[model samples]
Target: MPGERTKYAWRREILATRAQVSPAEHAVEAAALAASNTRLTGVDDVVCAYVPVRGEPGDLRMLDALREHGATVLLPVTGEPGPLSWARYEGPDSLRKARYGLLEPTTETLGPATVAEAATILVPALAVDRRGVRLGRGAGYYDRTLGAARADVRLIAVVRDNELVDRLPEEPHDRRMGWALTPDGGLRQLGRDLPVSPE
Candidate 1:
């Protein structure tokens, strides 16, 4: 029997099979790499980062580095089906538990209009291909959000090294990444900027 698989199944299988590493170590390396790359570019001012939930790629280290570099941070707040609201990330203290295991900011909530002002956005992905196409959590939150942002905004996907692969099933609306930050290899351009084949 050819059984059908749900989107949740794809997300679970990939996440379960991903390399298991100490969160602290991965956070340290990813933070240093991201910080270095952000400094070199000189364009990243306001960054969008996620609050670690369900053991995603980055921990608080990435947020800390961005703040230390004088970049304002924003986090996603669950909104309607196709849009997301962002709130200025003041600190860990400003977070409150939300649905889907996501910790969101409780300070000042902002509308989607503010996303355009961000110079860079660090997106969370389940898997990303060499073409920079990202497979997210399947809610289509980022796809809709990124679609509305300015074309020049740097959309970087943060993932474990192995998760950044050569190829993945892509949809037309899937947003591409300009860079990928991994613990092992530091920061590397994923698709548009580099000619490397997808792993």
Candidate 2:
């Protein structure tokens, strides 16, 4: 198990840095992030993504781009703190306020197992290291949920360019991201790839 204290420290520092990004800068980054994400999916592909809240990278446009590119987008239907259930994302209007200030799809839930349908998963992360260790918010929702997906699924961590860091503490339960999607870096493979760059 990784030290919770170290994870908490990393979360605090990254969030503090995210909080400093101005709205204008964030919007520009979001657009670029959305553009890059479009390359990952195509018609009929099942994609699991999330609504970016707080200072997380990208925005509704990212989801929209995926949908417009003909992918079936699924957003998390957050309930208690276990594995997250998923629902088909119709559009911005399809979302309703949910627990933790998240916007979830009003469409019928496809259940937690629906994650298995996705070819790619755009995960929300505070930071990700070259070794594919992802630093997420303290909640373990993703760690629990991702374990159910197919081993070959492309687990992509969505973060700002600078949020891609040198290293992070990892717990045995922590799910490793296979790729990192950044505003500038686009899609970069992790782990064996020593120098991260767009794929």
Candidate 3:
């Protein structure tokens, strides 16, 4: 298993070398593209976050698409060591700068119970392998937050096409993704099997 220190180093190296587009532009375009995809269905209530793209993760285009489709959107707020607090997202105007330069909703604060109602969750990941293992920024936030979700809830990871690789180092706490969304490739299911670690 990969150690936490190695995971952090790998994430830093990947972020340092990855090509990124403008957050604002990517957000708008990605949202439009995702909205056009037919696979993203039954998403009534969604739990997502506006992360800093390029330097952070993919744009919040997915969130915008969800909002445009009349689905209720929620943003995660940092809570105790392992959990996340959620707030109802109204729009761009309803957000304010929060920890880690993340733009989060400032409206009514909701707990894990409220987030559990979301039919789909858009998670931010550093990289996702074809086998569905997601490598995040070494943060266990999504892994913890997703514990509240129903077993059947769709967990999609938003990433660049190149970020979806054939393999990546994984650890026990690392959660798997059901689907991956990219600008070029709309939405593709990562399938259900976890990849075997390289010996």
Candidate that scores best on TM-score: 2
Q: Taking the tens digit of each residue's C-alpha lDDT, what string does model 2 give over 1-199?
A: 4444588888889889999999999999999988877788768999999999998999999999999989999999988889999999999999999989899999998789989999999999999998899998888899989989988899999988888888888889888999999898788889865445433
* Best by the lDDT measure: 2
TM-score for each prediction? Answer: 0.83, 0.94, 0.80
Residue 144's lDDT in candidate 3 = 81
Candidates 1 and 2 compared: the better one by lDDT is: 2
Segments in model 2 whose C-alpha atoms lie over 4 Å from true places = 1-5, 194-199
Q: Which stretches of candidate 3 lie over 4 Å from their true place?
A: 1-6, 19-39, 47-49, 52-60, 192-199
Please give, for residues 1-199, the per-residue lDDT of candidate 3 as tens digits: 5343465676876686564556585566565455543346544646454444445444455566667776777788876667688887787788888776678788978776765777777788877888888888756788887887888887877777677887777778777888876666667778743322111
Clashing pairs in 3: none
- For the record, the alpha-carbon RMSD of candidate 3 to the native fold, in angstroms, is 5.7
RMSD to the true structure for each prediction, in A, is 4.2, 2.4, 5.7
Candidate 1 deviant stretches above 4 angstroms:
1-10, 19-44, 192-199
lDDT of 3 at 174: 73
